[model samples]
Every structure is written in C-alpha cells, then in structure tokens.
Target: MTLLSYAKAMNRALADALEADPAVCVFGEDVGAGLAGLTLGLQQRFGAGRVVDVPLSEQAFTSAGIGAALNGMRPVIELQIPSLLFLVFEQLANQAHKFSLMTGGQARVPLTVVVPGSGSRSGWAGQHSDHPYGLFAHVGIKTLAPATPTDAYGLLSSAIRDDDPVVLFAPAGALGVREDVTAPLVPVPIGAARVHRAGSDVTVVAVGHLVHQALAVAEELAGEVSVEVLDPRTLYPLDRAALVESLGRTGRLVVVDDSNRFAGFAAEVLAVAAEECRLLAPPRRVTRPDGAVLPFALALDRALQPAAEQLRDAIRAVLK
Candidate 1:
C-alpha cells in the first residue's frame, strides 16, 4: 500500500488526466512554479504548453479558461487562494457556467476551477482565508469538497472529465490528511455522500475538513451515543437519498460546516431533513457564526469557526 497525502493524491490525479487526455490544460498564477503544494512538478511533467502559467488577473485568467473550454479544450484553472473566487465570480457564475444553457447545449464549458488552499490557512488573514463553496453552490455551480486523500484524487479526476464547470475546494485543513491506498485510484461520482461511521442514534453531516473533526467527536461519544459521520463530498447536487436513508436509521441530525450559518450548506442540509427526512428532534448545526468575518488574531479566528466540542453539543442536542 502507498501512503499518499491529500495534496500528493491530487497531483497524481492531475498527472493522470494530463497523460490520458491531450485536451486537459492547467492555467493559474505561479502554477508553473508549483507554488501550491498540489501542483508540484506538474509543469515539468506536462510541459509548458499544457501546464501554462497566466498573469495576475484572476478575472482574465478565469475568462481565458472559459474561452479555452468553448474552443473544445478542457481547462483546469487553479486559484492559489480561496478568496480569489470572489474576484472572478462574474466570469464563473455568469459566463462559463451559462455557456451550455445559453448556447442551447451546443457549447460545453468543461472547465475545472481548483482552490488548493481553502479555509483558514492560519495567518492568511480575513482577505486570504475564507470558505465560500456555499456561494458557488448557491448559483448552481457544481462544487466539491472532498474530505480524504482518496476522495481528493477521485473527485478531482471526475471534475476534470465532466462537461460542465466544476469548482473544487481543497480545504487547507484537509491537505495534511494521508491515506494508505491498496487499490487503484478511480473517479468518485460527484453527488455522493460517504458514511465514515455507521450508527443508529444520530447522523452528523460534515463538510470538507470538518469531516475529520466529526469522526473524532463521534469516536469520543461512541459509548454514550452512536454517531454516524456522513461526508457530503459534493456540496451541490447533494446526495439527498443517502441523507434521507441515514435519517431513517437515526431520526436525529447535526450538520457541521465551515461556512457562515446563514444560508450556508448547513442550512440546506437542515432544510433537506425538514422537508424529507423523519426527525425525532430539532436538527442542529455547528458552523461559523452568521456574518462572520474572521479576525486576524489566531485566537479570534478559531473562535469564529466551528469546534469539535460545538459539534458534539449539536449532536447531543439533536439526539435529545
């Protein structure tokens, strides 16, 4: 078995996609230099033509990716920081995302947008640190937030092959995860939920790096309550069936996410339970406080985000 870190798994996925498809190209700031850990050695492996580096303009480079996609080339644009997503939302949400529908299915923008370091990168400050997957999901853009090394490789492979614009947020906190792979890497379907732990007492839905925290909390509460940790790797096009089925067994739900509480992914999950699943008690969520602007101070930053204890409390609250 090979032990692969999350970043290394993504590197393998990009390398395989490049080798398998001539149409796949990666463009971004400092990508040729592999400034981001995930793109390490990609330029040398794929050549300057395919793994081209672009200028500092996020909007221009993002629009260029859309243009490349329109001309039948699949482009993967990497943004070094998550907050840059806000700078090019118009290009992504308005232009690239609407190409297929606007052209009546004649044009397909097979563009994959990658954010290698999403969420609090500790000292990145408020401007550089943010997790806005919910914003993209709100506009119907396909969003993926894989929690493990294996899922990182699989979901990325699937996103690159898809004929639509897909946003992949590799959580800064999840990048350190490593997995011993005894099997070959394969594409994981975009809209699937993985149950990390099976339980009959309560179901805990976690997003991105929060999945690991959820699992740990579940283990801590194993004797008192059986907690099922469900990771919705793909935030949008959510696996509602799996969620409802889990709720059938547990009758209680707790959602954990990094985004702000208001209109966040957590809110959507709770809405799903309210609409379709049978719940024995009110569903609760542990998330960043509403309208949270992460303070620069390390202590203040963590205070604004969700914690393991908060997740446990939320789980217990739901089970009551």
Candidate 2:
C-alpha cells in the first residue's frame, strides 16, 4: 500500500484529469512554477498552454476561467490563499453561478476553484485566515471540503468533471493528512457523507478537517460515550439523508465547523436536524465564535477555533 498525502492526492487528481480530457486546463498566478505544490510538475507534463500561469489579479484570472468554461474548456482556478476568494466573490457568485439559471439551463460553466490552503494558518492573522465556504454554499454554488487524502482526490476529480461551477476547499489543517492507499482512487459523488466511526449514543457531524478532530475525540471518549463521527464532505448539497439516518440511530447531534457561528455551516446542519429529525435533546454546535477574527498570535487562533474539548462537552451534554 502507498501512503498518499492530501496535497499529493490533489496533485494526482489534477494530473489524471488533465491527461484524460483534452479540454481540461488550469489557471493560476504561480501554477507554471508549481508554487502551491498541488500544481507541481503539472506545467512540465501538460505544457504551458494547458497549465497557463496568469497575472496576479484573482478577479481577472477568475473571469477568464468563467469565459473558458463557457467556451467548452474545463478550467480549474487555483487560489493559493483562501482569502483571495473574497476578491472574486462577484465573479463566482453573480456571474458563473447565475449563467445556467438565468439562461434557463442553456449555459453551463464547468469551472472548478480550488483553495489548497483554506482556514487559519499559523501567524497568517485575520486577513488570510478566513474559512468562507459557507458563503458560497449560501449563494447556491456547489461547495466541497474534503477531510482526508482519499476524499481530496475523489472530490477534486469529480469537481473537474462537473458541468456547473464547483468550489473545493482543502483545509490548511488537513493538507498534511496521509492515507494508506490499497485501491485505485475513484470519483466520490458530490453529495455523500461518510460515517468514519459508527456509534449509538450521539452523532457528531464534522465538516472539513474537523472530521479528524471528531474522530480523535470519539476515540478518547469511547469508554464513556459512544460517539459516531460523520464527515459532511460536501458542504452544500449536504447529504441530508445520511444525516437523518445517523440521527435516527443516535437521537442526538453535534456539529463542529470552522466557520463563524451565525448562519454558519454548523448552524445550517443544526437547523436541518432539528426540523426533519427527532432529537432526545437540543442539538449543540461547536464552531468559531460569531464573526470571529483569528488573532496574529497562534495561541489565540487555536482558542477561537473549535476544539476537541468543546466537542467532548457538547457530546456529553446531549446525553444528559
């Protein structure tokens, strides 16, 4: 078995996609140099035309990607940092996302935006530490956050082939995750949630990299509480059926998300659980504070983000 790191998995997915499809191409600022590691060696193998490096302008390159998608080219845009997503919000949310709906399904923008390092990086401070996947999900754009190396490869492969616009966030924390690969990588469906560990006491729905934390917490509390760890790999188009099924067995819910508290991904999960499923007690969520800004200090950053301890407490509280 081979050990595959998350970033490498994404790199492999891109390589495979480029090799399989003549229309598949990539665009970014330093992609030609393979600066982000995900696009490493891609330009050399695919040539400069397919892996084109553009200006530093995020908006300009993003707009170009939309145009390419409209003209039958499947373009993948790599934004090195997550914060740059704010710069192209209008282009993604208003333009690329609306073309199919506004045109009555006539226009299809097969654009894939990948943020290799999303969420808080050490000392990156407030400006560069935003995890805004919820914002895109709110606007009806397909959003993905893969927790492991396998999902990273599978989801990205599927995203590149999707007809509509898709945004996939590879969390800064999960980038280092490595998996023991025993089989050939395959495309993961867009709206499936994987239950990493099954339990009967409570179901802990974790998003993105927090899936790891939830699994760790579940292991630690195994003797006392039976915690089921559920990873919502696809943020938007959430697999509500899986969620409802998990809740049916456990009758309790806790969501751990990296986004802010108000109208965040966790909030939406809680709403869905409360509305369609029966609960033994009020569901709880462990998430970053309302409108939280990560301080420059790493300690403060850790404190603001959701922790395993917070998850543990929520799990215990629901059992009371």
**How many residue pairs clash per model?**
0, 0
What's the CA error at residue 221 for candidate 2, in Å? 0.4
Report the alpha-carbon TM-score of model 1 versus the true structure: 0.99
- Scanning candidate 2 in windows of ten residues, the lowest lDDT window is 29-38
Give per-model TM-scores: 0.99, 0.99
RMSD of each: 0.7, 0.6
lDDT tens digits, residue span 1-320, model 1:
99999999999999999999999999998888888976789899889999988988999989889999999999999999899999999999999999899989999999999999899988777888889999999999999999999999999999999999999999999999999999999999999999999999999999999999999999999999999999999999899999999999999999999998899999999999999977999999899998888888999998888998898788878766
**Candidate 2, position 67, lDDT:** 100
- How far residue 23's Cα lies from its native spot in candidate 2, in Å, is 0.5
Which number leads on lDDT? 2
TM-score of 2: 0.99
For model 2, the superposed segments whose C-alpha errors exceed 4 Å read none
